[model samples]
Target: MDDNKNLFKQIQALYRGLFAFVVAFALIGVGLIAYMNNPQLFTSDITASETEYVPIPEDDSDKIEDGVHVRTGFVEADGLMETVNNCTNCHSSELVLQNRMSKENWIATIRWMQETQNLWDLGGNEEIIVAYLVKNYPVIKKGRRGALTDIEWYDL
Candidate 1:
């Protein structure tokens, strides 16, 4: 009975401590919010903090317009006009952008599209489109990171 009482008292003490810690964290969060809203209330006589106020940049120059997104870079190439003429009639530029293939692979893909997706024959324009795809969208060797070593496996 005495041992059980002691264990219960320990658990009660632990819960009280946890509750106190949570209340302290909440109060600190509320205080920080209030201070941010009205700095004058919290800065009566305290020295300046080490943190400096760095204003966020307010410029649109950072926004780059790839031809795919902004119609600027897409139609600039010689053979790309043929690609756009035939390609966009069926699917989006996003589909083309996602794929990276060689000239032979591009031709194979076109043949597959004709066979399955009911794409029309490009005739002489197929060569132009293939050249453009090979030149612009060759296979990008994305060296992905391998699985993480020394992982600390845990159970819930």
Candidate 2:
């Protein structure tokens, strides 16, 4: 009975070792498959020459009426990039888009920001940014929706 008990204990230990080996083998196989799929994950060496640089076009004519920019969603115009760099630094472009104020109002808003919101002086770039805002997004009179036309009313 003592010999049988010792044999059972040895068998259990062997099974546990085999299980652990199988699990380790599976993990290694999974890692190998992942590496095979995308070897770039394992590669740490990246050369500077491999990096890509996109040049900004000198011509503004194509972009003037080319519609809104994909990333910023700012209307395409002469000073689109300038406006993006300056305005979007502080707040979201949506804040600019939603309020279609005139040049004077825009300046007032800028002044208010400067006084209260810790906005820095824009200097000469202010002209470009303001021009972009005024020309592209002038004050729109959206008083009310068209008089609730074509609606069927039920009697209470």
Candidate 3:
């Protein structure tokens, strides 16, 4: 009876140690992921080289029908453009420009970032981003030329 009781206690102790170790490991893993996904905490050390290309502003006065300003250069629309504050903190504007998505998808992506990736809120800027994405990144439609004409093929 004594040996059985001792064996049971040893088994319980082993399980307790294992449980503690697992909990500690899980906590550390969560911490590491949170740190890595937190854009506010992460930063890039890369610098642009002299050979790197920079986009030059274009003159829009000639393009516009009226005296009103039109978007002819990148900087002209920069104010109205939606920027993911957290995303651009470590990434470049080109990165944002290259990626495009619908308004719904953008909202979902932002939510995912907020829930799991530790992305910060944009406050009033959220509307600006959503509007910009909807206006500029609308879904693509099929071209008229792609559809086959009735006279193009004869019935076999």
For model 2, residues 24-135, the per-residue Cα lDDT tens digits are 9999999999999988767775774477787886764324335877557798888888888878887898898898999999999999999999888989888998998999
The candidate, 2 or 3, that scores higher on lDDT is 2
* Native-to-model Cα distance after best TM-score fit, residue 125 in candidate 2, in Å: 0.7
Mind giving the per-residue lDDT tens digits that candidate 1 earns over 88-139? Answer: 7777877887889977888899999999999998899988888888888888
Residues 1-156 of candidate 3: C-alpha lDDT, one tens digit per residue: 999999999999999999999999999888889888874444553553336686888764335335322432223233343453444554565655665678898788778778886777878787777666666655676566575666666689
Q: Show where candidate 2 strays beyond 4 Å.
A: 1-66, 142-156
Model 1 clash pairs are 67-73
Point to the candidate with the largest TM-score.
2
Clashes of each: 1, 0, 0
TM-score of each: 0.45, 0.49, 0.38
lDDT of 2 at 139: 91
What TM-score number comes out for model 2?
A: 0.49
Error of 3 at 28 (Å): 87
RMSD (Å) per prediction: 23.8, 16.9, 26.0
Model 1 regions more than 4 Å off: 1-69, 72-75, 142-156
